[model samples]
Target: MPFPIKVCAVCSEEFELKPDKPGFANRCPECSIPESTGDSSTKQRMDADERKNASEANAARRQAMRELLYRKDS
Candidate 1:
């Protein structure tokens, strides 16, 4: 029998469950599969670093804009 269709929690994509599988999955097949890196920990670390870098860049831009507006007031 075919498994019922379900929504993935991570990607919010619709997918069908595998009837041959024994357990339930919260994420879609794409999201469920980890990055094909030699080391999962390294991949996770790189992702974290990217997030941090992007966050820092955004904060810097906001600060620069605030300074520019302040200069206009002066």
Candidate 2:
């Protein structure tokens, strides 16, 4: 089956919407390519650290909520 035709959100060009297309469904492949920013490894590591910190914070928030909901009356 032929891929569906989609208009690019950025350049306003028509492109084939394939299953392996990167970035967003609304954006064309050319527009989907991410601009390089120095070392990718370092950036990935920083992103991982940020995700870890965010996950920890979320866990703490859930724990606080659980405590508040399950705490016994004094």
Candidate 3:
């Protein structure tokens, strides 16, 4: 099947919207190229840390719920 045609949000050009296209659905491939800032690595590190902390918190919450549900009261 042919890919759907879409108008680029940035350049206002028509382009094929393919499944493997990067970035946003509304943006064309050329316009979808991510602009790199010098702090990208730092940002990635921060994001990883945030994900780790969130995972830990979620695990703690699940453990608490399990204990509460499975506890025996006499």
Best by lDDT: 2
The lDDT values for all models are 0.76, 0.90, 0.88
Error of 1 at 60 (Å): 44
User: Once model 1 is optimally superposed onto the true structure by TM-score, how far is the C-alpha of residue 34 displaced, in angstroms?
Assistant: 0.9
Measured against the true structure, the TM-scores of the candidates, in listed sequence, are 0.42, 0.51, 0.49
Candidate 2 lDDT by residue in tens digits, 18-70: 99777999999999988775656754454888989999999999999999999
TM-score: model 3 vs. ground truth? 0.49
Q: Give lDDT: candidate 2, residue 2.
A: 95
- Clash number for model 2? 0
lDDT tens string, model 1, 31-72?
766565467555445488899999999999999999987876
Judged by whole-model lDDT over C-alpha atoms, candidate 2 comes out at 0.90
Q: What is the lDDT of residue 55 in candidate 1?
A: 96
Cα RMSD for predicted model 3: 5.7
| Residue 60 lDDT in candidate 3 | 100
